[model samples]
Target: MTLLELLDYASVFVFALTGALVASRAQLDIVGFAFVAALTATGGGTVRDVILDRNPVFWVAEPGFIAVAVAASAVVFFSAHLLESRLRVLTWLDALALAVAVPAGTGVAMTLGHGAAVVLLMGVATGCLGGLMRDVVCNEVPLVLKQGELYVTAAFAGAAAALVAAQVMPQGAALLVCAAVTLVLRAGSLLFGWQLPVYRSRPPRR
Candidate 1:
């Protein structure tokens, strides 16, 4: 399996797990779990493929991705109750998914001979869109747009890191740097409360 494919699978499974957990929290049934899981798992990558005009979208090319998402949903459907803090687990797992996914998108753009701008945008889209879809579908606050969160910023930074590292290293190593930087930034936001400054709309002129 190529690195991009591997990253796709990894991110799909992880993102699916987060989706299932969300479904559980929403008290949804097994079918609902599967639907949400599959959506969250493939949403971002599907968008990436579509935008790049890749003939068959990743999951459409290989249905195994959908199966993997269903399997993840099944696992969480039966076990979500054991965790006292499903939200915490879901957050970290989403962070992991983001990290893996960003590299997948970046690698694809690079392989297709795209410039840095496309590569960077693809990376951010692949990492953030899945979770955004998941949250919106589940009627939860989209973490991507949460106040001052590092989610999108982290993906942008990670993609930038990969672009720079690609000049001095192999594709595989550059992607690893991408994942590491993404995970660290996202984890810091979740664990250490790292935040960006938010806009405050003050009353116009006194």
Candidate 2:
């Protein structure tokens, strides 16, 4: 497969793995695990495709992607006891999936003649929304909404980089640059607790 194609499949698998991991952490049953895994694997890309009017969506068209999601959920369901800590692994997998997906989403959107705003939106959705859904379904606060580190912001930053680089470089180079930026920004946030400001509530009026 070509590099972009490879990255796309890798993103799918990593996302599936992380999704299943989250479900496992929640002590979900087999069907629940599968539901979460499939949702987390395809939710973001489905949203992007729907918005961009892309046909059939990726997972719907690719049976292998569904197989991968099912297999990932199965593994997690049966092997949860083997994991020493699910959260750490899920976080790392999420970072890796975002690095793979941000550029792919932006590049695909731009290739289809989407404007910069649309490209950025697609990239952010592709990079973060699946994990956000996973967290929510697992009864954890979505990371993007938490007063923690800059999660979705990193996706936006990388999408901005891709939007600019695609204007100068070829699609491949732009994808690489965007992916690199996303990886660096996200990993830094995780490692350093680099959070965006959380608005504080005002005091009660008299």
Q: Please name the candidate that would achieve the greatest TM-score relative to the true structure.
A: 1
- lDDT of each residue in 1-206, candidate 1, tens digit only: 98989999999999999999999989999999999999999999999999999979999899999999999999999998899899889988999999999999999999999999999999999999999999998899998898978989999999999999999999999999999999999999988999787777985577
Best by lDDT: 1
What's the C-alpha lDDT at position 151 in model 2? 72
Question: After best superposition, candidate 1 residue 197: deviation in angstroms?
Answer: 2.0
- How many clashes does the backbone of model 1 have? 0
User: Model 2 segments beyond 4 Å from truth?
Assistant: 202-206
For all the candidates, what are their Cα RMSDs to the real structure?
A: 1.9, 2.8
TM-scores, all candidates, are 0.96, 0.90
Error of 1 at 105 (Å): 1.0
Candidate 1 lands at a TM-score of 0.96
lDDT of each: 0.94, 0.82
